[model samples]
Target chain A: MTRLVAIDWGTSSLRGALLDADGKVLEERSDARGILKVPQGGFPAVFEALFGDWMGLEGARCLISGMAGSKQGWVEAPYCACPAGRVEVGRSIIDIDVRPGSRIAIVPGLRDEHDGVPDVMRGEEVQIFGAMSIAGLDEGVFVLPGTHNKWATARKGRVAGFRTYMTGEFYALLSQHSILARTLDADAPLDEAAFLDGVTRSENGHGLLHNAFGTRTLALFERMATPELSSYLSGLLIGEELRTQSLQAAGEVVLIGASALTQRYALALRATGTATRTLGAEATWAGLHALSGFLDADRNPP
Target chain B: MTRLVAIDWGTSSLRGALLDADGKVLEERSDARGILKVPQGGFPAVFEALFGDWMGLEGARCLISGMAGSKQGWVEAPYCACPAGRVEVGRSIIDIDVRPGSRIAIVPGLRDEHDGVPDVMRGEEVQIFGAMSIAGLDEGVFVLPGTHNKWATARKGRVAGFRTYMTGEFYALLSQHSILARTLDADAPLDEAAFLDGVTRSENGHGLLHNAFGTRTLALFERMATPELSSYLSGLLIGEELRTQSLQAAGEVVLIGASALTQRYALALRATGTATRTLGAEATWAGLHALSGFLDADRNPP
Candidate 1:
């Protein structure tokens, strides 16, 4: 029976699972192991320190993905290029001397060039590939949402191109430090109607940068309620992304990166004219498993 | 000799100068003294407790501005309407628990409703009016840059209308917390061509909202050095503000709010086809010193 130890390290946290050949998690462990928070060149040490108890087994293969490969990590890996999807798992991902795993590898994210502008991503690419693997689909789009939202178009086991948006990051900054922050006393739920209203306004030619502060004026003037403003702002930012990013690709299948924080985006994204479905927490774990399955079937390091 | 106390109490800070009739400072002192920072209804007590030494001088008067008269301050004062230059200082301004000064009054800021948008300014309104007092010009435009950047048009001592932009706050949020924050290292003087370059791009029908993420992409692609991304992002935001806000008001005299933070907007203002000058600090003090001038000349209780 083949066993897989999979890791999904994200911007601020690390989670892992030891799974049986059938894809059921054996014993899972997680810790505050985000790459940004880790000390310089301390990825391996911190991971082992947090999850050493889970590594009691012998001769098990391990796979890792996420920002752990960027400059802030223990070792840097070059980002894969455009029309990029499922790069071969790097066998010698890093020469960190540590754990006794039989073999170790890291999945590469996707990248693309637009108008002389280049974009790159790491963890979400693997998840997109994994989502595709499970769906058994060809030529579709997948979106992984967060502070740095990632959108990828993949076909025949390759990502054609992808884009990233600063929705979550922008939300945090405006909510915490800016004047809009002062006015917001409570968290607001995502209002699809409000979101659509924002999209309509944006599509009607309200400049996103120009009308950003007007949301406050709207609140002050009592034209829009305070809570609805959040979703409106979301619509404004996401609406821009939909219109601008869609110029190149007419994506068919919209695989949403779903979470408590992400479900709000699906509301605004309806304006993009795509068929949407949410890939839940299981899909993240499933995406990692898909990579493991590919590796096992090939058994080759490319 | 007439003694006067000039006080400026803002949201988070308070500054006061005890001066002779000649405007010579006899003593100056400030504490953790914003209207918001101080305890509620503690204004009269705090003033007497803190400035007791400067009080009880014969024929002395005091002038106050800022949130001391908003709905939530020590007492409520009606807002002066638009095209607002300088409103006459109020006789019974604050609902003080105890009468302390020989003569005291508060200057109300301007508020206006334009195109269905309601806007208000408290202390800066006083400062701007003070600026016009020095210039002896009745009709002009004023640019008060801050967390909420405002472009105001005034005519014949009345503020006509104003629009607020979150340019400064947006820049702070993007540089300190967003993906742009991760991409940027520190502050750097942006290329004027690059800033205007971004403005030109925003002016296009494409919308500046979707294009903000380009800052992150520029760094990932190595097109921009990591450190310069902040400035570039700054350029993009301010550029959008210039293109959008300049269309809101018309006035040849761009009296910038006097501040280090506000000064950064000078270059951006100059780009908007307007002559810009920083408001002199003395102008505000002189305008408000009228408690000993205009009001006294009228022999009013204020």
Candidate 2:
């Protein structure tokens, strides 16, 4: 596998790792080119300022992933659909002529329809494929929980498809912007009992899309505490979500997408059933590494 | 019984009706001095502008209810506790050393604790009795659905007490200010099955708060139409509310409060159960009328 430039560019920052053919990080530098900040003279200046000093970067090839490939980022490379195995994701690179740096290419993100639902991803597609490597590539489910949590299914080391749920974002907005916002403990953690209770309730035929405002009633007339009410609200959401996705996900190993914001979901899933395990953000490095290998293999047939 | 005055003043408008010796609308007038706007304006201008012609309103005593009697309204008056029948809801009959011809007495609204929960009411106390009148004034549960849907229990024409849920206000905020707002059908009636479906779903167990984002999920994943989703969401919220309150209410008739908003709630209730009925907003008026009769009986020594 030829060593080139590795990039993990997300919404708030651009991180580039200069690697050797052996996939060793020789030197690394990062800049603020997050998706949210791109409109303010993003990716180009940041990439230049951070990697300009790496001599090997002058002629080496470039492989990038993350939101930097989004329509709003450094170079808008439309996402590629899956069966993406790292090689296709990392190797099908696109060039950003904005800067002079040998042969440059960006790893395409992932988007596909699964079970009649449309799904999408930007930088994390590479990481997902990467994580599949160390975790051992096989048929399974991969999750990345956040404001917009992604749940993807892969078979034979190729991502079959994925879907997105704005549960976290909705929770955040309702917890802070609307009337319920006044009652939320913005910093509180999940109430496990509440989550388990939610799961328990769902099994009894409770539906998420049917009943979300039970939170206020519980608090107002029932006199349930605020924190507990919030947890219950989250539980109903996560519970309903699990109910929606679980049938198709049975027996598939649940690879929880972890970040600080996702711990609650991880906890909820534990009680809600469906075998699961955790992989942290740092694992994205592994995802990046695996993508590099896939890119190499794709470019040179055995 | 001498004829008196009737008033219905709210957040944005002031309505005054001068009744005759038999409690008929002799003359009426209204203005834009809802409490939120003229918080500092005294009642003289408001009353004069509307009922100025009745300066010599002979044999006329006036009775008033609403925010006009709030702490910030014309004259500050404390609330009367529940189970309170025909309590003066406004400032006492201070002679108009200032007004000259009318023995003006503002009916102070009622307030009270019911079932260990803190509760209060102002303009609606009379409406409670009015509704109770139709519901048999026997022991039963009464619901005044609106921006603050009140669930009150009454025994023999007196308000036992009630709990307020910000159902209407919440529906407004969510559908207009929050993302859920995007799903509403500008032309759809509240009678849509989807709305009732939401109410049913609310009662389904996971409850309303659980299914709050169902509209969004359905739209995003299935490309479900918006107006249908809106009706479903509405049903979901109100349904959860009804479910919770039903349990809390036990076995009592749901005497609904009146207004455009209350009517929709009545429709939703009719779709679900027969224990619900819409009550007039003028029960407070009739109760005040009854109170006026009670007052007259006291004065005449029957």
Candidate 3:
């Protein structure tokens, strides 16, 4: 029997997994039904349509994370202040009114306001907690690579602080919309050498705004081919992120994300003389599972 | 008589000026007809439509600069190597065939192959040459700010060496396409304080990939208003460009570009402790006219 339903509802995609009481995932499903593309029936209706069987089941709870918790999401789950963990996130879950007599809990995102500038993350917080749980560590730096890459520090089983970098988003914009697009091959395979070369360039301390011109000049001079330009750009961006962020202080960096991007980050980090460990999407599942434990405790106090 | 038609044909716009035999401006005109927008009739047809009367005038020659010399322009006016001045640029102009027995010369761009990567500029070279002519500087650094900001060094009245920074292009992409776009007010008036704040941030030695995130967080936390974000971003990018390109050695920097942008660069350079002198787009006219002199000389030997 399905004990719980965990969903990662992001900006552009929705992923759901049904888990047993022991937290073993029984079935998984995903769709392009992101919050940005909700159907005529609103988020509740769309959630029902996508996970009908799992819903309305007796004693089975549904947990949601990611942008679904934002102001633009199904229900605004106000962010919990940072230096938080599973209990902090769990206690902050807000209920969503839905049909079929279901108990739906939306995981609140984490916010770090100490930096003078407010930085917040919804889905990545779950990944952070999950990576911490999986790595069996109480303190570490977790690098979650995505459209907006996140760098979170975990201390004593709680997120200490984190910052967001628009690395992937800027890469997409540069590769697709800027003049540098003229010299890139979007469809080409990853060129590791060029990507590493970009990482090497980043290490030189030449600011990114200046080094980026090399993307064109290198191609123009035949020093780097068009196909390699994409990877080189990727390396440069990720490398700069590593160079500037305070991720080096952590003993071992934990990279949690999809393998393709995580691998690239790992390569960049390793090249910079830092060791990294990779965790897949299951880390999110594990994080959601751990947070669900808090929900169960709230529903039934000992 | 309309002695010469000097055109600055760039990627997105075309500007033309009519001059007499003594290089005095007779009339000026500009249009959105950049090389990127030529219709099915081709460049000659577009040129004729834009400047019809001046084209067929007796002894009215045409001189074109900028991307009109690029591979995608009307005809590729190959780049003249650096350590070159008016004479080199003039001799390198390639002829374009048009109606009315007209003689048209497209100015060659400059290429600096001294650095491992090849750096090239087309119309800006004309402006640099023009700035030299106007300021009477035999040697100095001339910064031409635009889509691709060029930092050119002149020694003995010739372009010594230069570097290209994608500052403007990167700013455009970040403000219009990246996630930070949501926090910016593109139509807002310039904010000098916020812009200087960005310059101050650049001085902290944090790489741009890290600094750019401030645009988002500051706005999110209400520390920076939307309108101010644009100028702050501008300062951040321009500051990075100035920091990385090594323009400090020159005694006095000559900034040649549009007034508004040059003013901003002037502020940025000043904040960085460097003095600047501004030159308007008339410099391009002067450079093209000086280059046009070469064509007249070829017609009637000295």
Top of the candidates by TM-score = 3
Worst 10 residues of 1 chain A by lDDT: A88-97
Q: Could you arrange the candidates by DockQ from highest to lowest?
A: 3, 1, 2
Candidate 2's DockQ: 0.12
Candidate 2: tens digits of C-alpha lDDT, residues B31-127: 7878777736566776766765665555666666666666667764567766665433322322233367565555566655423334455576666
Could you list the CA RMSD of all candidates, in the order they appear?
5.2, 7.1, 2.6
Candidate 1 or 2, higher DockQ? Answer: 1
lDDT score for residue A120 of model 2: 67
Whole-model lDDT, candidate 1? 0.65
Q: How does chain B score by TM in each prediction?
A: 0.82, 0.83, 0.95
TM-score of chain A of 1: 0.87
- Model 2, native contacts kept: 0.04
TM-score: model 1 vs. ground truth:
0.76
Which digits, one per residue and each the tens of the lDDT, describe model 2 over residues A1-302?
35567778887677777777655677677776577876566566666666655524444656778877776677778767766766566556676676544555677788775333345688777667666766776667777776666777787777887766666765666567654665667567767676566555544342332234445445544556766767776776676656556544356444545455456666667665656667764456566666554444246422
Clash count, predicted structure 1: 8
Q: lDDT: which candidate is best?
A: 3
| All candidates: TM-score | 0.76, 0.64, 0.93
Interface RMSD of each: 2.9, 6.9, 1.9
Tell how far residue B226 is off in model 1, in angstroms.
7.0
Give me candidate 2's TM-score against the actual structure: 0.64
Question: What C-alpha lDDT values do all the predictions have?
Answer: 0.65, 0.61, 0.83
